[model samples]
Target: MSDYLVRALAFEGSVRAFAVRTTDTVGEAQRRHGTWPTASAALGRSMTAAVMIGAMLKGEDKLTVKVEGNGPIGPMIIDSNAKGEVRGYVTNPQTHFDLNELGKLDVRRAVGTEGALTIVKDLGLRDFFTGQVPIVSGEIAEDFTYYFAASEQVPSSVGLGVLVNPDNTILAAGGFIIQLMPGTDDETITIIEEHLSKMEPVSKMIERGLTPEELLFEILGKENVQLLDTMPVGFECNCSKDRFGSAIISLGESEIRDMIAEDGGAEAHCHFCMEKYNYSVEELESFIDEINS
Candidate 1:
């Protein structure tokens, strides 16, 4: 099925939750980045979580997530908006390792536990909102949970996972985020915690063909959940040739002259989508004239 996420409220708005199935979406990222099994797992997990978080915003608002770890994967960055668009890249995509003790991809090893997860939100304000928290578990989900609690002061539970195939492809990818709104009773918190503790890994569920709605039912109970809006999610990048052209012009006339004299042409590559835009010497000369005039 196509990648999509569902938003819901349970127990009459006492609980807010989001669940997503991102197998195809994350797979696209793996193919784009040519990420190894472990790096794919780490990047996929972060992207899945970022999409769910992006759903929390209003129109035109967006957020960027940065995972700066000391592991082999280096730093991972994801940008997402309320419209369900997301783009991300890892500093090192070729990193991978054998399974850990649980016989799963060694994401923790690929994403070291020695750094922070920072989130910058652009709420259409003069100053953007920024939050940062130390990585509690390089596992992605737990680290986001810690981020919400420590950085945003919201008590939350985050479960994110990604399964990689032996051929260095993505098998499954998905996640869920459940947050307790204020005024939740003590009894309700305990019950939700119990259910969360007994839940299966999110990626495994997606691999089994479970939808986002069913995933939330598994966590919040069918009788307790109040279904909200649903949104389609996918791997999207905003890069364009026109944008690259503007960038070339921004390099100034002298720089454009250097390109024309030395290389005959210039090529620009986008890190997020691996797309290349080529400009001939003629195009560079035009840009030089535009900048000079």
Candidate 2:
């Protein structure tokens, strides 16, 4: 099934929740980057959480999430917009190791415990919003939970997981974020917390074919959840050959001429999707003339 996300409020608006199914989205990233099992799980988890955060924005708002851990997998960078588009990459795509004691992907090893998770939000205003929190757990979901509580001062529970196939493809990937709104009564918070404490992993639910709405129901209790809206999500990049061409021109006539003389053309590769764009000799000549004129 195509990937999608849902936003909802439960417990008479005292709780906010977001859930997403990101199998296809993660698969696309894995295919493009050729990530190994552990690296795929770590990067996929970050991308899953990024898209849910993107849902929190309005038109034209965007955000970037960075996981800079001191592990072999290296730093991970993800960018997302309010329109549910997201793109991400890890510094090292081929990192992997044996499964942990829990018989799950060794994401913690691939994304070491020694760094920080930082978020930069551009709301199209004079100043951007920035939040940073130390990595509490290399298992991204718990780290995100800590980030909201510590950085944003919002009490939240985040559960993100990605199951990778033996061949380095994505099997199932998804997550959920449940937060207690301000002024939420103690009793309501305790009940929601109880359910989350005993709930199965979000990836397991996705593997079982549970929808985003159903996942929220499990977290908030069906009687208390009130579905608000759902949006389709995917791995999307806005880079194009024309955009790269303009960038080449921005380098000035000297740079364009150098490319034509030394390499016979210019080649650009997007970090997000690993898509390559090549400018032929003719194209380079035209750009050089445009810049000179």
Best by lDDT: 2
| Per-prediction TM-score | 0.98, 0.98
| lDDT score for candidate 2 against the true structure | 0.94
Error at 221, model 1, angstroms: 0.4
lDDT of 2 by residue, 1-293 (tens): 78999999998999999999999999999999999999999999999999999999999999999999998999999999898999999999999999899998899999999999999999999999999999987999999999999999999989998988778889999999998889999999889889988999889999999999999999989999999999999999999999999999899888888999999998999999999999999999999788768
- So what's the TM-score on candidate 2? 0.98
Instruction: Find the candidate with the highest TM-score and give its number.
Output: 1
Q: Taking the tens digit of each residue's C-alpha lDDT, what string does model 1 give over 1-293?
A: 99899999998899999999988888999999999988898999999999999999999999999999889899999999998888899999999887899988899999998899999999999999999999877989889999999988889999998988878788888999999999999988988889888988888899999999999999889999999889999999999999999998988888888998899999999999999999998889888788778
Candidate 1: where are CA atoms >4 Å away? none
> Distance (Å) between predicted and true CA of 194, model 2?
1.2
